[model samples]
Target: RKQLLAREMGLEPPATVELQESDKEIDPLQVSVLSVSSFIAQMRTVVGDGEATESARAQAARQLVRLAEAGVPGADPEQWWATQTVAEERPLNNKPRLSPSRIEALLKCPLNAMLKDTADNNSDKYHLVRGNLAHAYMEALGRGADEELARRETVEAFEKIQTSPTWKRAQERDEFEQLLVRTNQWIQETRGVLELVDVEVRVDVESEPGVRITGYMDRLERAVGEGGEEGGLRVIDLKTGSSKPSDEETSAHPQLMAYQLVLAHGELQQEGGLTKVVSSSQGEERDGATLVYPGTDTKKIGTADQARKGDEELAEFAALLPPLLDELAGPRVTARISPECDRCPLKPICPVQAEGKVTTDVNA
Candidate 1:
């Protein structure tokens, strides 16, 4: 009908298209567009053929299985097989380090966490850039940078970052500047509570032998008691996003809990160079952990019981790591689809998503 209409409009009929034969040679890149299952099915034919040698057939079958298990789009089965084989044979003396954020990510979806480590999909979205700038400004303030210098440096740093290709398309430049101003104002307003401010301090605690939990504390403050004695340690995490603390989120807040555990174990003071300052103030206990959202009326403070619960949860998670690592090291790793799949970069090729098992609403 479209051809007839075109002819009536004084145009020649479109040329008839010829379909390529199914057995015709195809570009390797084009073959990458095939679904993992379809590709595996095709590979199976070669593996089952009597003409192929036993060793060659076995190798092809192994490659097919690896590709199916990877569940990532456009991943080269042969390359993945070779790389995984080499990695499997390597001596893994170095223990895997778990940060609070990484722990949270793993809990949401193990496959997502694994892909985050291996994928090169780093983002410089508005929120991420603003958060980073906020952190830098807070770090400078904590490190004793005069308010004026800190403000100037933060703006300069952000300006330099704006020139980079990573942030070339960053939106909301004015909003980011306002955020900096508000952050500086917050620093000034909270100076009384932030008597001893340590910024970007590295805290490492070995939950168990050969298993370590490591992270950087954005701000660690030494609070003063009513009687002028050392009150205790306060771990404050800055947030630039819209997420507020809820009973559910705070109850299992891995980051805050990790900070509490580190402080409870006295590792934050001992290993993080806080011993001198902390000891000088007579070695006070942990007061609590707070998530501070500057420029917003949102502050989530975890109770003492919540912090202790976090310690227990961390231990339990550590105990489960060996088995989880063993499973991931094997040829096949199961994907447990959840609401998190909506944001997962691998969802495009995820077998579970392909099968329509993923939920659409993250809140649901």
Candidate 2:
């Protein structure tokens, strides 16, 4: 139908090109500076190194005291930098989402939302560090490289958080280390079982006419082939945390799903021309994994059943685009005590909470 429409419109679709550039480049300097600075500032407060820079910093310092009293060296400094660098790359603007975390944050607290969206700074408490560690490790593993080395690197990064000099207070450092070791070990075990292929792809897409979304996927693999033409794409979303979310949660989660949708669009450019979804989890230990969907790529139509049933969850997510954009651009009715706020670590700093309660809670 798309081809026919193109013909009717006298347009010839351009040939597809495989992407060559890698994921966002990380400057070693930038990574080191940001991580080291953040870590130092955090440590200084924890040790009462200086007067609290701010209320949040003071809160963190107090929290660190508790961690120390509980016996937690602090995370390895090196690990902290590595993970923090990764965070800077896949930030909100560049990240695609059917249901953005930022949107969820905004729905919960507008002020908290502004801090992240407009200010471009997020409270460290909710930073998805564990998820990122798992993701980084998974990406390395998928490339069929040194798994042990990847594991070690990830562990080291994690340890950086466990053993900072700034954490001079009393706590059970051994206990925290033990937990981290167990967590990483389990992640290593899970990575050991998964199959990965060096499926490199270049995706050239237009988010809308004249606005293109072009990028390359370093690795791709087939988790399941629904037989012949209907097989699906299951792109992995390596996570450091437990993967326990349901299919609904996976489908509803935006980032991972957006990645899947991106992959699907790339697949559609080929002959078999199918919509692919890249699905992955944080890891086995934290829970399991959270799924996310961006959108489909194929212009081809499928059987009504396939369209309605197999892909219904994804379709529904995509349908949310309009409202999401509106909310982002317009004045949002303020609300409070959102159930979503529970998972958010920034709730304390959130101004909406300072105001009052409002809105529908999807989780509720």
lDDT of model number 2: 0.41
Candidate 2 on 85-130: residue-level lDDT in tens? Answer: 2323222343332332344454445445555444334434323564
List TM-score per model, in order.
0.61, 0.42
Count backbone overlaps in model 1: 0
- Once fitted onto the true fold, the runs of candidate 2 whose alpha carbons sit more than 4 angstroms away are 1-130, 163-219, 224-230, 251-260, 268-313, 329-337, 342-364
Q: Report, for all candidates in order, the number of backbone clashes.
A: 0, 48
The best candidate in terms of TM-score:
1
lDDT (tens digit, per residue) of candidate 1 on 75-148: 35444322333335543433456665566666666667776445434453534665787898878777777877
Q: Which ten residues in a row have the lowest lDDT in candidate 1?
A: 275-284
lDDT of each: 0.59, 0.41
Candidate 1: where is the Cα deviation over 4 Å? 1-93, 117-129, 163-171, 268-284, 295-334, 355-364
Question: Best by lDDT, which number?
Answer: 1
